[model samples]
Target: MTDDDPDRDIRCQDALQAAYRELVSAAIMAGWSEREVVLAIGELADKHLLSLETNDNADALIALLRRMT
Candidate 1:
């Protein structure tokens, strides 16, 4: 499939979700609390966001994070 194929986006999203679930499950099995796992994900997101240049997408991400609280 070409990069422009919309189906690719959906497939990628599905794959990402599966990987996320597996990682979270592994972390929990490793004795990390649910809250710890969530906090760790938030920290990772924060670090990635800091590297992004300011733009509407960044603003939207920040807003979404705020809404989660």
Candidate 2:
């Protein structure tokens, strides 16, 4: 990963909650239900090793998850 990559420093910042919120918002806007959005977010977060205490590599993860549906 390059230093300029936005997700590069997410692991160093406590941005997981914000990232999760954004993911949920996007999913809802994309017509997914609350349960579907939550499941998708959780799966994506776990797949990417994201946690509340971790900097979130959420940008790419969110993008990838969105394509699943």
Best by lDDT: 1
- Tell me model 1's lDDT, rounded to 2 decimals: 0.87
Please give the range of 10 consecutive residues that has the lowest summed lDDT in model 1: 48-57
Instruction: Encode model 1's per-residue lDDT on 1-69: one tens digit a residue.
Output: 799997998988787998888888899999999889989988998978766756667899999999999
* Candidate 1 segments exceeding 4 Å error: 1-12, 54-69
Q: If scored against the real structure, what TM-score would every candidate get?
A: 0.54, 0.41
Give the Å shift of residue 56 in candidate 2: 21
Best by TM-score: 1
Q: How well does candidate 1 score on lDDT at residue 37? A: 95
lDDT per model vs. reference: 0.87, 0.76
